[model samples]
Structure formats: C-alpha cells, structure tokens
Target: MTNYDSAFRWMKVKNGRLHFASIELDIQKNDFENKIVDDYLVNGFKNDSEGIKPWKKGLIRGLEFTLSKSSNFWTIVIKELQAPVLDSNPAIIGYTAILAFIEKTKIIIDEDDLRKIELFVYESWKGSNADKVPNFNKLIFE
Candidate 1:
C-alpha cells in the first residue's frame, strides 16, 4: 500500500465553511491525476449554507466518476459508456469517501466478493461523520 498523506494537505472546514488552503499540485506527476485531485480540491469542500456544489465529476481512461455530498454522507457514482457501473453506498465525508470509491470500483471486477467489500466499507465508516475532518497524516492506497 502507498501512503498519500498529501492528498488533503491544506484542506479544512471552519465556521461551517469549507476552505482550501492551497490548490498547488506539485506532488502528483501525471496530468490526469493532477486534474482529478485539483477538481476535488476546488469543488469537494462544502460550505454550510450552500451545501455541496453539485456533483464533481472526473474521467479516468474512459471510466467516469462523480463525487457529491448529500446530508452528511458522500456519494460516488462510477459509470462506463454513460451507463452506471457502480453506485456506491453512502459514505461519511472523510476517509470513507476514498474507501468507498476504491471499494466500489473494485467491486466492478470482483463482484463475487461483494459482501466482504461492503462489510469493509461499513466497518470503516460506521462511527464516522462530517463533524471532524480527519488529518491526512496517513492515507493508505493500494
């Protein structure tokens, strides 16, 4: 697993307003990856009054994904050829967002192990919520 601690650098929420301390992308080398991360940084943060600013979308090698916040949960929808390929269960707005995205995409290939992945997601985000944004000290990704 690789740790992406810089993923949430300079990101936070204060006084019910989402804040992005910086938008520089010196860490990621790939342009596509940088674009994806940039889009998330620019549109992902939520302001209390306006809520989430609609669906934030991205496309990776023809695979399309969208990120949106509803209530306190973040929703990720992955699509192929404009058809829904994976509609993830709602995840709390923290590491759960990344977890859901990774797991749900994995499910597209490992459909037989659905229960296990679902369980993992449920266990990861069970007691989490949006009140506290986790420090991006260590985000493990395989």
Candidate 2:
C-alpha cells in the first residue's frame, strides 16, 4: 500500500474526530472559545455551506485556535486536510482561505513553507475533488 493509505488506515476515528498522532481534527463540534474567534465570526462564516455547516464551523474554530497558539499554523492546516474524513472539504476550504489571505496580505512566510503550500494547492486543484469546491487557484490570484 501507498504511504497515504497506510497512514490513513492507522488514524483513529473517534467521536467523529480523526486523530492523527497528537493532533486531533475534531469534527464532532465547533469550539468557539478561541482568541481568533472575532476574525472567523466577522469573515470566515461568510463562506459557509449548508451541507458542511458543522464541519465548516469546526474548521474555522480550529483555525482560530491554531492561529492563536501555534507557530506553524499553516502546516497544521495542510496536514489536517490529509485526513479522508467527512470534514476534508471544510479543512480544504479553511486552508485555501488561509493561503489566499496570506498571499493577499503579503505575509512573510518561509520559502519552504510557501513552496509546500503551493505544491499542496496544485495537487488539490489537479485532484478529482477540485470540482466540488471553490476555485482556490482563482482566489490566490485575486
């Protein structure tokens, strides 16, 4: 089996949350108790969809938490998307928006991190699931 298949199969799915090592993509519920809640409330919720509403909420809340506490929030978002759970789309949306925000604001990200983000974006767009989500590539350029 491929590395992804092996790693994915080993991940624990509990309480609707995918646990990858120590990081948990808690899909069960949205925890709004975070420092960056204001940004998500003011801006992130505008992109929510009906089908994945809860997942989207959880994603935004997770982003808020990560942004407040993690130095490598971008990496966390990217890795979170690797989970083949129901909230993959939500995670994708969250990370795509984060990448677009970074690019638009000219945030000083490390070269390696930027390259990894670009690679992930390219692979995501080239995947079959690309049609199901917004055109993230266009958003990056916009």
TM-scores of the models, in the given order? 0.23, 0.31
What's the TM for model 2?
A: 0.31
Best by lDDT: 2
Off by over 4 Å in 2: 1-34, 38-49, 52-92, 100-108, 131-142
Model 1: worst 10 consecutive residues (lDDT sum): 79-88
Query: Please, what is the whole-model Cα lDDT of each candidate in the order they appear?
Result: 0.26, 0.36
Residue pairs with colliding backbones in model 2 are: none
Q: Which candidate tops TM-score?
A: 2
Please, what are the lDDT tens digits per residue for candidate 1 over residues 1-142?
1124423222333334332221122221232221333233322332222323211111221122212211122322221111111221122232333333444333243343334433332342234322222222222111
Candidate 2 per-residue lDDT, tens place, 1-142, comes to: 1233322222334345443221222111224432322222212123334654534443453345235433332332222323244334433554444443344334455666545543443443334543344332233311
Candidate 1 regions with alpha-carbon error over 4 angstroms: 1-35, 40-108, 125-142
Model 1 steric clash pairs: none
